[model samples]
Target: MTAGRVVLIRAVNVGGAKLPMARLREIAAELGAADVSTYIASGNLLCTPPDDPDAFDRALEQAISDEFGYFREVISRTPAELSQALTDYPFGEAPSGHIYFLTGEPSAEAASDFCSRDFGNGERLQVIGRDLHIDYPAGAGTTKITAAGIAKGLGVTGTGRNLRTTAKLIELAE
Candidate 1:
């Protein structure tokens, strides 16, 4: 019994991965999702998935790939999960930061090794469950830390949402 899910598609509307939000919402509706909507234009989709959340995620991924010619990973979490992840945010309150929703929990060794690296001053990150909390004091756009760097460190792919977007997603989902 899922209430709703926040669907995050990695790195859309940036670089070359162009995904129209309208098309995304349309595809989701075609897949039988209910309450279909999108936030901003960066591929943040909110909907009650048509079937099993996992299956819905994969199918949406496939649909987008088939339509757009790029295969970006789709990560989904319930409103409760998002709220809990927020509660677990380790960096306290900061003006600029992001929560990278990883594809899966990193292995113990990978997590440990990643944490051991010094990501530089005014920059911090922690692997909390499947969410990587990152604080970018310098700013998100210019920060040395990146989703690819985190993926390499943790051995799992992910998409990032700024703290504001994360909070808004939770609010909208609820």
Candidate 2:
């Protein structure tokens, strides 16, 4: 009964706090949604909703918090949006050495400063659209760039997942 596309939520598997994929489906169902499915353990959800999206978003956030007894920030991404994010990675490096920092908003200016400071030489980064692709070919050698550093530099909080994980998420979204 859902109209429009699926909503992909990020960062529900951090800090030893786990949100079961089944519960996610139930939350969506509580909001009058159906055909709910989850991908992997990183809180990716594909659901069919039967209500206003904005309202559904808020309701889901509250429901998740109430069920988990804690609060988590949820960002929604459509299937097309996920596909475009995957396509934005234009690096000629090994997939393992690269990671995509999923941001809730575009931080091109901030990302520029991030690339300069946190990243060492030859480490390229691009803030294309709403996604930030960071390629570290040297395997963090001589570079202390961590997920926290990138998140702080970009002025946003995000979970950094490897290229393989990104691909899997994209596949699930599709």
Candidate 3:
């Protein structure tokens, strides 16, 4: 049996987001989630949320906003879905990349526009459903395609976690 969903909160513990993991777990528990846990300080939450996971995602987002005085998108995925992302990774085990978990899959036109846009060399982008896979060989710090750029191009909300961290979250969720 799978553990549950991996709830990822966008841009936490960085740039003054400051969401404490212990408090996060407490919030989830208050919301009736079971087996609540968190990974790292970057807002990776693991739990079997109450009722619908999507609903839980939204509730968590709201709760965080209410309690922490800031808003952040909370995106969740089942263990199977997380595993599928690993399998669907287009870089084929290149070992370094990130998966941007979108609120919903972008439209074909948006995906095409984002794909066609020149973000500079050594950066490969592949849009897979709600996941945007990006591989920037020279390191993300040097990439022209940024989080803001992605949001603008895709016209959607999302949060990104690196490939290794994603694998770790999957392991923890299972």
Candidate 4:
């Protein structure tokens, strides 16, 4: 059976880094990724990865850097893992929330420390495994819990998807 995975590319098509979705899809296909499809323009990709997930991740990263000269972090998660993250989300029903999936496991202490930090404006955060659920009652645009801040606090790399995008990605994975 082909193993499907979601790949999130960070810092792409933003600032001066231009990674067009069409080029990304073509590159993935050339790298032997099957059924490659991209969601939106923020670098969310769904595909059947090569046999080795770790090797594929590294090769994809290298290919992007080599091809586009844009060295952004790439994070991947299986559909099952993303589904569990959605199931385990603790904030009941939040209309405005984001899920940040980490590339590496953060230390328990780091997670706890990050959770305990005060990110005012009705911001709530919960860390489960490598997934961090953040609800911003005051809107994420104005919130202080940015990707850079999260990486700095947790000592890990991650890419975030808003609730709607998260749900859509899950659906596409299925």
Question: lDDT at 75 for candidate 3?
Answer: 89
> TM per model?
0.94, 0.76, 0.95, 0.94
Tell me which of candidates 1 and 2 scores higher on lDDT: 1
Candidate 2 per-residue C-alpha lDDT over 1-174 given as tens digits, one digit per residue, 9 for 90 to 100: 322544655567777668998888888887887667876778766765676665776688788888887766555566666667667777754554454445456466786777666344567777765576777666644556665776677887555556776666666655
Worst 10 residues of 1 by lDDT: 115-124
**Model 1: residues with Cα > 4 Å off, grouped in runs:** 1-3
Winner by TM-score: 3
CA shift at 106, candidate 4, in angstroms?
Answer: 0.9
For candidate 4, what is the TM-score? 0.94
lDDT of each: 0.88, 0.66, 0.88, 0.86
Tens-place lDDT digits, model 1, residues 1-174: 234999999989999889999999999999999998899999899999978999999999999999999999999999999888888888888778778899999998898788777766567878889988888888887777777888888999999888889999988887
Global fold similarity of model 3 (TM-score): 0.95
Pairs that collide in candidate 1 are none
Model 2 alpha-carbon drift over 4 Å, by segment? 1-6, 51-54, 97-103, 120-123, 138-147
Name the lDDT of candidate 4. Answer: 0.86
The local distance difference test score of model 2 is 0.66
